[model samples]
Target: MIFRLSPKSRRNLSRIIPYGVIWLFLGWFILTLEFLATGNENQRPETEITLSFGVLVFASLAVFIAGLLMGVLEVFVFKNLFRSKGLGAKIALKMGIYLLFMLILNALTFPLAASLELGTTLTDEKVWEKFWRYLGSVTFWSTLISLSFHILLSLIYSGFSDHLGHGVLLNLFTGRYHRPLGESRIFMFLDMQSSTSLAEKLGHQRYFDFLSSYYNELSDAIVEHEGSVYQYIGDEIVITWETEKGLRNGQCVACFFAMRKQLESKARYFQEVYGVIPAFRAGLHCGQVTTGEIGALKKEIFFTGDVLNVTSRIQKLCKIYGKELITTQVLKDQLPQAMADQAQSLGDLELEGRAEKIELFSLA
Candidate 1:
């Protein structure tokens, strides 16, 4: 059977591959060794016989196929069903999906091992008795295995995402940045507006909660616009993307506006919950930056150059210039015509600690 995956689904599928590879190899080794160690290979448990093989080629294929199927199905669940639901609801949904998929797998593989004999050429009473026993065993083991796998996978993905952010883990591990490299990238510095006053109004703990919810609200827009979160510093977030990805559909610009719209829509909700509405100021610029992995104790893929400096300065100018979003002419020049036309001149402006004046623009 052929299954087509959407881009988002493909991304989710890619995340579990490393774990799946290790699981496949480990399962094959343990099962083969255990069967051989039994000393009576002819006599096997039904499930054991199904996965065992006389030839290494067949054994490898069986292990690979089982691993591939389970991995794909579980990832599908993660991508489609695992939304930002409540904990109780998510767990119940996952258990249901696991039980259903496991039964489907058992149906397909039992016959492949020619172990479907339990129901064939047998009296109805005998077949029903065997069927109940088979169902009971499969249900017990499938639940146990699925729960363990889900827990392990969650931990792996969480730890990976927390430290590395999204979409850069494999690249780092593959030595994609062994040496300093130069590449053109779009950078945005998003900072919460009136942060000092807001902090005073809400105090420390409440202010931290506000920042958390504020960033959480922007997470969807970032992913939807296909942007990578470079870093989070205090109350500000830094986002970056390779030139092509950022400019492909003008995500670099559109993302900022999308975030504004999202917050606007949630304005009433925020007011009711936090007793305050949050606003943001952002700056955009594009240029070449030196990129490489930095630090030994706390290793990081770092980007360094004037591009970041310029972007940060522009963000600071938002309040000074009385604009919510600010961008340099350098970035506007690279945007597509449709997006470029949205920019109207804000005139040349001098940035702090910089000798050269920059031509700036604000989007309509």
Candidate 2:
């Protein structure tokens, strides 16, 4: 009987077919050797070999079909069912469960096949005796080992071959796929000011080298502050932390400033390498954003909303106000008394496309 298969199922079957053929050939070769050594030359050698080959082929086909069915069930039915857990955990769990299922199937088939009888005593004994005995003995152990090996190999291959495919599948099946659900938050955009002008003065190769070191220093600092890097635009780095984390504790913001200080020392190395030192300007603002994967083929987590736009505008305002860092009143309101004293108020300034002028401040 023909069963309709999904595209995914067809793909999985295609992968299984080649492996099944190889195992079938191996099983036939091993069983053929046993038949030749045991069966007498006067007792019709061809008939004995054919019977042995049929049993081996049937057993091999049974194992292959069981694995193929389990793989199909996993890809189609189970994958969407568990879609709440993390990807890695889900795949590991599914593989474990699949292995257990195959073991159970083998257990059931062994006894049932052994109990079945053919017409005469010789035919009955010959059909059930060695067939079930072999399956219960070496075949069972071999199948277990081979399956374990396949799982390990598949995981290793998936890590390098298609990590995202595996990741997406895992997330989808385990129900672990979550879009960022946090409140409207503060975002900081830090840029190396006049970077283009500096790059032009320095040669292309030297400028590229300086940028590499510069980005490393910035990334290290952002990570230290527990900020997620949104993206790097030219020589600028955009980083974000939960507003509550940064404004309430102030640790995140403080760590970022400390990172800036560390970069200042690193700037000396850039000066030696490219004959120019880099300066950075930053801006911070608080607002709501939707953060999730965007793009069909090349997916990436991106934050989108007015909050992101305003943060960029505030960074540009750093050049207008002649300050290293700029922050909005929203950020100031959330700051502690002592930290607030360090900020220089820039009063209200009209920003492009805004209905009202915004109150801004600079970090001293």
Candidate 3:
């Protein structure tokens, strides 16, 4: 049952379990102190001490149960609330809500536990006497201590959890922490031609392994070329390099072809081992894009605007035109005169959304 916890729940449990265990030990320590001080197995100590200890035990148990329930709730029920928001905001909101809930639950449990005392003398006379005397001492001190402990735990849990969650989500969303935005850049989208068919033939696990290797190789190549990976959509990888470099030297384009040859070699190796090879098609274009973090609780880096959309459209055209790689006129215009001759024009092609036809070229 514990293993069945969702990723988010598991994260919450990780934060709560350590503190909960420590408090459990502390509760036991307090009980031991009470026992040693009283020197009685089953008898109450001083009326004041007994009430104080009882309140301490009750609060400790309340905290434990509340932490468990709240951890689970945060994992499953409130998971979406943390999605799409920044790490700081998400952690703060969750901890604030959980702490508030704990306060309410602990407050309600006080009267109930007091009412259900067994065996001991807690009559109207004794109870009234104990209540007034112990109330100021036990209630104030314990509440302050519990709240202090809870705040400390919350801060630690929120800080560490937010740090990790934010790092991972940032990678998943934008593929980097510091994303450059609102700039003209060369965007490339590479996709495996028949990934669905390959997946069907290879089975889920094997196909996933193939995708892992494919993405790894592609990412390595992109990084080597000073390109940033924006995101992946199934078998497709969206990447970007600054237009200044891409246009000035055609280094990014050269890197793309070089990576293709490396991938071809990898395909041959996979074919020898698994009797199958995956083919890929890629599209490149140069234009402006807007990039930034998006979502509320589970924040992600996002790239939007025409360049990203057009790059993807051009990649789709690769499948239609039966080409390995395609580039737009924007890319051709930017390339050096010597490098420009290496590319062959495919003339103007009408894209799905654009009213004006886009000029296409094939990499030689």
Predicted candidate 3 versus true structure: per-residue lDDT over 153-258, tens digit per residue: 5445545544444334435534653564577788888888788888898889888888877776665556456566666778887777778866656767876876
Q: Record all residue pairs in model 1 with backbone atoms less than 3 Å apart, i.e. clashing.
A: none
Candidate 3 residue pairs that clash: 82-297, 83-297, 83-298, 84-295, 84-296, 84-297, 84-298, 85-296, 85-297, 85-298
Best by lDDT: 1
Best by TM-score: 1
User: Candidate 1: misplaced stretches above 4 Å?
Assistant: 1-10, 16-47, 50-154
Q: After superposition, how far is residue 246 of candidate 3 from its true place, in Å?
A: 3.0
- Could you give candidate 2's per-residue lDDT for residues 269-340 as a string of tens digits? 877777676778888888788765556786555577888888889889989878988888888777887877
RMSD of candidate 1 to the true fold? 5.7
User: What's the candidate order when arranged by decreasing lDDT?
Assistant: 1, 3, 2
Off by over 4 Å in 2: 1-182
Native-to-model Cα distance after best TM-score fit, residue 42 in candidate 1, in Å: 5.8
Error of 2 at 220 (Å): 2.5
- Model 3 global lDDT (CA atoms, 0 to 1): 0.67
Decreasing TM-score order of the candidates: 1, 2, 3
| TM-score of every candidate | 0.73, 0.54, 0.52
CA lDDT of each candidate? 0.72, 0.65, 0.67
